[model samples]
Target: MATTSCDVAIVGAGLGGCFLAMLLRRRGQNVVVIEQGPSIPSAGADFLKPPGLRVLARHGLADLVGRHGLRRDHIRYYHDGDPIQDCRFPDGGFLIRPYRELVELIYTCCAMEGVEFWFGAEIGDIAVGGGGVEELTLADGRRLRAGVVVGADGTRSL
Candidate 1:
């Protein structure tokens, strides 16, 4: 059996996982992305709606959003069929961008940067060593080792 090693192991193929994988690879780290799901679709309504926008902002992605997003100047609020509030943003706006496009871009960058990716592979168990995870056992019974493991498996992740 052949075993593979990496400096970073990313679990998940969601937006965050893909982006982080590309970013880390750009920084010259050997990265591996393990995804339970298939690849991100090329066409979808995935965009930085309210929740995603907040997450992006907190991660210092506001500038990126601004550069790659559609911005709106005003936000309208209605309550019971009546206009309640109209807020104006002086320096910010509703940022909109296709989530699939961003993911595709990141995935391409990851590929170009040599971030190894495995799809349809679910992490079954994690072996912890020292201060971080040492290896991950996949559903296919393959053991992969890494210096750092990132659990971007989302909310329900264990």
Candidate 2:
């Protein structure tokens, strides 16, 4: 009933999907985020370690994310219910924000970059040839053709 296209088409709206979509949009690529669910995912890793934090910082999102998340410089390690070690961050601290909140924040930024989102859009099939995906067909018969197709579905997926 509908048709759309973009420079990039991403499957799933999880953390990786949303994050990658944001990055691509920032790179001047028209992005389409397709999610089977009605909304972004609500649960996932809650810790943004130093490396991940740096990625945000490099993208100019450090302050925006840090403002709304918890900053902890120390992490206490436990083994068999025993606190065995405490690791301290030498530089910028880590961020502790719910996965949903983190993705939502990035999604907000993506919106400003004009990234398109399709919620409740279940993919039916992908047309592939010449060693790459060429198009996507939704269950409801919608078509999407993109120069690039990303399969960031979930932790465990097809």
Predicted structure with the largest TM-score when compared to the true one? 2
- Runs of candidate 2 exceeding 4 Å displacement: none
Which candidate comes out best when scored by lDDT? 2
How well is each residue in 52-139 modelled by candidate 1, as lDDT tens digits? 6676577555566558678776768899989999976554556667777667766776787798999888778888878878788887
Compute the lDDT of residue 140 as modeled in candidate 1: 87
Angstrom error at residue 55, model 2: 0.9
* lDDT of predicted model 1: 0.76
Clashes of 1: 1
After TM-score superposition, the amount by which residue 14's alpha carbon in candidate 1 deviates from its true location, in angstroms, is 1.8
Put down candidate 2 lDDT per residue, 51-145, tens digits, no spaces. Answer: 99898889898888888789889999999999999989878778899988888998888888888999998888888898898889988899999
What TM-score do all the candidates reach, one by one? Answer: 0.74, 0.90
